[model samples]
Target: MWQGLLAFVALAAMAGCGEQNGPEAQMAQGQAPNVKIAQPLAQDVTEWDEYTGRIEAVSSVDVRARVSGYLEKVNFKAGEKVKKGDLLFLIDPKPFKAQLNYAEAELERARAKHELAKNDLERAKRLFRAKAISEEEHDARSKGLREAVAAVQSAEANVYTARLNLDYTKVRAPIDGRIGRELITEGNLVNGGGADATRLTFIVSTDPVYVYVDADERSVLKYRRLGQHIGAGQTPVRLAVADEDDFPHQGTLDYISPREDTATGTVTLRGVFPNTDDLLSPGFFARMRVRGSTPYPAILLPDRAIATDQAQRFVWVVNQDNQVEYRPVTLGAHIGQSRVIKEGVKPEEWVVIEGLQKLRPGIKVNPERLSLAAPY
Candidate 1:
């Protein structure tokens, strides 16, 4: 009787197992995988080129002393905006005054000599008429008068030189700009060799700033071949700065190099920026974009959707069976916060953007269609 009961229990267990996976499971076997697979969607993707750049002053002037003298007073504060011909520094005038006095005295002495020579010439002519003096003596007097007149002219030139030297004591700004730090203090003598002398201060024009960006030979050729010539003929260059969220200033392409740099394999293109508020300074790094090129329609994927494999970049594609498959992709230039997808998955296909780590091929899954919770 016990053996019969055991056989019956075994039969019931087998029947229960059969019913668990009934006809419903067999019907869903092919369609279950395709029921809901999450994959990244790729739409239209555009192309763009980017370049890095830095801000600089177009006219950077270093204020130097023209004449050697003690720096008596600093008329303007450091970092102050100054106009053209503004007084920047003052030198001690005592020594220049003495030199001018000497020149004046010499001039006065020459004038006295000239007057004496004039009287002597007149007397010599009178004596020659009366035959009271020899011809040689009259000629000697005439020669003396000529020498005296030449001396007067020499003295006049010396006076003018002395006046110019005195004027040099007062130093003025060569260009209208914002001045930098003071190199020499009051009572310190600065040499005035001009080019060879150390700069007393720096003066850079802040109204308009210049920016230079590197464009490689390939890029230049590419643009030229496309007939874009985006760097030529007053083409507008857009600027992107690190400090600003949006493009704050608009610049135009002012210069494009003819040749490429052998060391860097790039050519320098220059742009002029209007820094009216003095916000842009030299050495600030920024990005440059060439305008006038037609933007292509492109598929943009958010930064989160892409993943990297060893030596290959791919995205997880959920198949009809709810299995994740790795799809290799090629990415193009950046578009705002997203990247332009050049190759890989198609649009509207569910890409495993989330829950990718827990997936394998042919794994049955309970697919929950994820919705975009926040707008990017």
Candidate 2:
């Protein structure tokens, strides 16, 4: 009987202890998971739109002969910098010089004939005054003098033409630019100043180059609206050529097509950039970007904070109740370490940046708010 009473007492004590520990076990287990939260950064930022484009010279020229002749000499080295009025090529100047000399000689002979005719008219005038010559004879001498004067004028014009032909023998650069290879080498016969004129070479302006891009209708409209506040060239732009990691070149939007292409439904845009270093060249593949909008206040969060469920992007927000709630957000371009949240997220809201996996809608969390600055 004593053993049975001891066993019953021990069982009663164990049962009572177990009942007390049950509530404490449940209370202490699975405390709210600790998480880090931060308010979205409010900043004023300007967004940019990117496009792929090709570099083009501000001006390009196809050098051609202006007078038919055998090319006597090439004045410039292939791939050289040339300035306006710089002599580029010399045609067979010997022929042009001879023509000019012949014209000058003809002009001198015309002057001598004009002088003799004037002398004859004077003599005829004296004879007419003394009645030693008929009126018809005096008129004939006067007419001869006029004909000689006309011949002199014609010869003068021919001399001017000859001088121009002589100058054409020396082909000069029409613009300041970089010249390419000599297409018609020395001693080659070249046709000039007509439909069949031979091309001598090519040249293109180097500094302050242009970049052209085709922008869609939507972008065109946006740019037009932006233009209401800012001028066309006032919009900031940047460019990067092939092998460049970043847009080191700065420029501005200079031109926009008056109409869109009916077939492509896109408009052309041109940006002009200063290339003092001559690093940018014509026909180079490049990447360009234009400022999308004026600086505006925006909310930003770390990219890692945002989670995607199917196509929907969301973030876990801790409300005043210290409870996690699912919130969808509209994200914009990445700005350094943070992403712009255009909509569905407020700058003052606490967004869970870490320990996001433990979050569930309506779940309580121990939020340790942090002050995290964007790297950008």
Candidate 3:
């Protein structure tokens, strides 16, 4: 019985030894492991710097009255498009009209007085030449005529002012834009003129909207070095609204601040985009990006192939000998699922894209070559 048990144990040991020599066990004993490898894709690419920005109207105005009076009529609908010089509101024109009439009547009275003074002066001049009247009396008459002439000139000025005020009673649009709702409704007295004038509504131009963003000084300098001129419309930009996942709006850089904000160390930049469809509105939050660098040749690799070790980024490279090598790299902007390799990797070198867990430095690999035309 003991000899039979010993034979069984011996057979079990022999079976275990035979299993160790199979395919799986051979891999652990220095047989090459299979991995996917591909050379980096080389192409001309541009880098874009992203920023949070705000959409604004190219032209904005706070509508107000130039003459003070009770609002008589609101001529425009709330949030409607208006043309320049379009009648927007009507003040109490009755009072202004009456004032204008009185001024005209006064002007006529002054003209009559002026005519009488002219006749008097002519007679006084004749009397002085003939010595029929004393010189002092003639001089007094001449001075009286001069005073009348001054009064007439003053009355003419009053008439001009009255006509100007009458025209102001009919409020008109100052520019072409969309108007807001009336804040001072009909029958409400609105103060006009001076600093305390009441605000009736607001208007903002609809087409060709503006977007403002603040960029760091370093970035601004870089853009200047790249030959992006302010207001030249050469530099291109892109924008996306809050709900959008990708930038769909295209615009051009139209303005850059002449001075920087010392406190924040950032300069303001403005981009202009056409809003003929009225999709963009002032005060909307948006994400914008500016072309940071011109197109240049660069090497790119799949983002998944790169691994982070503490603070450093690295990747596994498969050389011509089919041996894995660890390499550190400098990275640039991310394009889709691929990363731009700024340094450390060459265009012709093959990088491991899969089976990274089975890789170690100096270990042989059975690499399956793949094309990097499309990212994986």
Candidate 4:
């Protein structure tokens, strides 16, 4: 009887030791892991799409000499602001002036001859009426008068042409903008007023600048369906330069190419921006963003709450029982710190924003409820 009682006590002691070493012992002693969670935020949001592009001038002009002559003077310094009709270059005007003088002398001579012929024709008419001159002689005087008048008209046209040529010697700015370096310097002979005219310099309008970008076919279709017409100048856009962290420049969509580029599968778009302070320039590499979609209510969660599982994206959703489960989600856009959840998550449901790494699907968590406004 004593041996049997001792054996039973020993067996109970070993069993107790085995129970302490088992997984149940850890379960009784260990605490649930702490995690922070918040409900998804639902708000009205507009999606923005980004693009890379280049800056272009709204108006650009290649200054070319309009008349051939030796360049005598450059009126404005290179890289300076100039207004319309401002003199930019002066060709040698001596030849044009000489031609003008000759034309004026010829005009005077023709006028004198015309007056003499008119007087002669009048006298002949009177003589013919008085039967003092023959019909043939009177006809000859009339013809001479007409010839003199034709000569006078031709001389007048020559004078006008000469004056126009003289004016062309003084090259003026065609637009108000900044000018580039002089390509043709003083004393250089420049060919002008022809297909192969010499380019003196170039200018670009600086006030209202243009930014050119290309968008894919899908984006174009999306914009069209959303009624966000980029060509109508209603869509708003923002841009930043390479060194800029934020988009400081604002503009409106002004133009869209009529046809898409077949090879590139993109449509060219232009945005107009007011560069009042001359902060923007042409040929600058820029990052542009335009409103991709209209404002609509969306479910949003902090980006930190999102987790990736191989090919899938998910979030740790806390159920009513304080348990976490992997919830697959479809994302839309990331605005600020919140990402748009297109599907798979409801606004009323809480998601684990903190302690995501310690979470597993269907695991119980000690969730300390936190607001989305809390910093990580």
Q: State the lDDT of candidate 4 residue by residue for 68-91, as single tens digits.
A: 999999999998999999999999
Off by over 4 Å in 3: 1-26, 29-36, 228-233, 320-323, 354-358, 362-370, 373-376
For residues 28-119, what per-residue lDDT tens digits would candidate 3 score against the true structure?
68678999999999998888888898999988999888889999999999998999999999999888889989998988998898888889
lDDT of 1 by residue, 21-40 (tens): 75445434643332333334
* lDDT of every model, 2 decimals: 0.74, 0.90, 0.88, 0.88
Error of 3 at 121 (Å): 1.3
Model 4 vs. true fold: TM: 0.84
TM-score to true structure, per model: 0.66, 0.80, 0.84, 0.84
lDDT of 4: 0.88
Stretches of model 4 off by over 4 angstroms after superposition? 1-36, 134-136, 225-231, 366-376
Stretches of model 1 off by over 4 angstroms after superposition = 1-48, 104-157, 194-198, 223-233, 240-242, 289-292, 306-331, 341-376
- Model 2, span 1-376: residue lDDT tens: 9999999999999997786665334334647778999999998877778899999998999999989999999999988899999999999989989999999999999999999999999999999999999999999999999999999999999999999999999999999989999998898999999889999999999999999999999988887778777975688888988898777899999888999999999899999999888899999999998888888888899988999999999999999989889999999877657888989888788999999987778878889999978545
Report residue 132 deviation for candidate 4 (angstroms): 4.0
lDDT, model 3: 0.88
